[model samples]
Target: MQDPLPQIVDSHCHLDFDDLAADLPDVVARATAAGVTRMVTICTRLRNAAHVRAIAETHGPVFWAAGTHPMSVADEPMATLDELEKLARHPKFVGIGETGLDYHYTAETKALQQDSLRLHIEAARRTGLPLIIHARDADDDMARILTEEYRAGPYSCVMHCFSSSAELARAALDLGFYLSMSGIAAFPKSAELRAIFAAAPLERILLETDSPYLAPPPHRGKRNEPAYTAHTARVGAEVFGLDYADFAAATSTNFDRLFWKAAAWAKAA
Candidate 1:
């Protein structure tokens, strides 16, 4: 029997992206059908914040974050903190970013990535919104930047789709940030990651799909969606040796506490 999806939440998603937009209602239905109660559609570029907001306004059990992604940030180099702050103040906006260093995909230099990260960090501090960070192949710099940024702003954040070293995890935890596990954690070679999860504090752990991207095993090498979060959660539950109901409850609670400022709005809906 499938475990009851007691309180599953997709702390990060990208429903506003075009591939999923055409079937928004259907996707929402699929998410609900799968017992995925809530999802925060991420804002990759500031230019798309309106699209993200539109989805939030029109959909129940959906929310949006307001900030540009690091890889996409250099394209809009002039995206100022004032601009991010303005969009961030919207009731529909919960988090400040999916922004950080990414040395894996493009040839973009570290300087550019850090510049964008700093912008989102400032926005998070100014608005008290949680930050959603993405780091790959640059964990050291990502952690160092977060350390420097936190010294100034002390904002809450989550290391989204965490697939980095134990040291990077430790650094983020020390800075009072939550760590998000995505479908990637279910991979066969992710044994070290599983070990980290075994030792991770449940209170500081969040679960996500990073959907349309990292499809968890049993569905890997295919397009992913929010509904698949259940699979990832199961993998996490098994890896951590916790009951599914208990694990889901803890993850939802972690999300609620970290983004407590948005809790009222999420509840009022």
Candidate 2:
């Protein structure tokens, strides 16, 4: 019998990163073979934005996001809101960021990061494209900024690769943003996250590989790719005690709603 659950969508990836680009075609083919039929390559810098766009255009099943990563923004050319707003309007660029606060390294100043993120949020408001956020060790700030910006305009956001406090998770969900889970949820000791996964609404949850990193259990510490999204999906299904096919379909549905229109998926048999 054919599986009732639909194919998987890797909601976030750095497939344009050098490691994946070196073997892009093979990577896509293998991912398709594994039922990960669609993927989104996120942009981390404007200079490499063209490469992100090219991958999406080249692959009928792929989509892409533009706008600089917060960490990359400080040293990047499009260092102003106007510059970010200009670049985020490309028809192929469906989302505004990998932009948000990241205080993990302690090297980038918080004020600088907030300015960069605020710029991207404004761009998202103008473009009406969803914002892909990367929040690490700054969930409090991430939540605060998102709340503050909400009053400014109607803009969508995603806590990409979510690994934050329950309070932050609750705040984001309350504000109608999706929480994207990656391979990290599959780690042996991620009981707390698995607990959070249990309560998160199926509709509001999304899955990703964040490839070239966060390779799940069996493939842990290995070079990750979109094809490995199945591992993450499997883990997610287990977390919710859901039928694997059902969870896959739910996650894919969230991906479609959050990303740009795709004829390939809309016209799927």
Candidate 3:
């Protein structure tokens, strides 16, 4: 028999999205078979929190986080600190957001996005959950806001699907925040991105698929799912020059450290 693959976690994904939700059981089964033992499904809109929360409640290994995505900050009802604080009370709610600036598509809403990100940061501080950030083409502002708010009071965080500047990486790391490796880092043309991750301390790295999006090479352009996290983790091992099992263990430890609620829940189970 083949040796068991190293266990790992998909630190961020959107399972409530129709593509993955349409066939949830099979999708989760494939993830389990591939050794992705846990997944954090992110709810991008506060309105969808019920649906996302239910997905986690029904699935044994799924946990969740909720926030108003920066791209939708202008469109969706603005999120409030009280609402986010209440959501954090959920037993399976493991993080504060997939929140931050996404100026690439929504530069017009930059101010609103910054406001939302600060509220999410406050919620993360209050709940003691890691803040999940999604930054795109707003590195300067992203770094600035994170630094300013962190000075107001430190809160744990992870830059989810980090494909940003090396300076931003250094800024985040300087704040003791983690940088998550998504499928993007595993693409053939992402050598520079991979190098950025490789240069970071291995203990601060976490693995994710960010699916149903950014499926890694060999599955690039295809709809992604938690099962594909192993593909990215394999690349992470190469980037760190460690065996696959060792990389998996390291990332899993990083995940537990940031998403401690998930670890606590698993232990209780």
Q: Which pairs, if any, clash in model 1? A: none
- Kindly list the per-residue Cα lDDT of model 2 for residues 122-174, writing each as its tens digit: 88887777889998889878888999998778788888998898999998999
Candidate 1 residue-wise lDDT, 1-269, digit = tens: 97655778898999977768889899888988887888999988878778789999899788888666777756775468888888877877888888888888854666877887887888888888888999889987888899998887588899999989999999999998999989989888888998887778888999999987889989899878898898989988897788888888888888889877557786786
lDDT of 3 at 140: 98
- Model 1 spans > 4 angstroms off: 1-4
Poorest lDDT segment (10 consecutive residues) of candidate 3:
73-82
What's the true lDDT of residue 24 in model 3?
97
Better of 1 and 2 by TM-score: 1
Candidate 3 clash pair list: none
In terms of TM-score, how similar is model 2 to the real structure?
Answer: 0.93
- The 0-to-1 C-alpha lDDT of every candidate, in the order given, reads 0.85, 0.82, 0.95
For model 3, residues 1-269, the per-residue Cα lDDT tens digits are: 98888999999999999989999999999999999999999999999999999999999989999999999998899898899989999999999988999999889999999999999999999999999999999999999999999999999999999999999999999999999999999989999999999899998999999999999988999999999999999999999999999999999999999999999999899
In candidate 1 the C-alpha lDDT for residue 21 amounts to: 82
Backbone collisions counted per model: 0, 0, 0
Best prediction by TM-score: 3
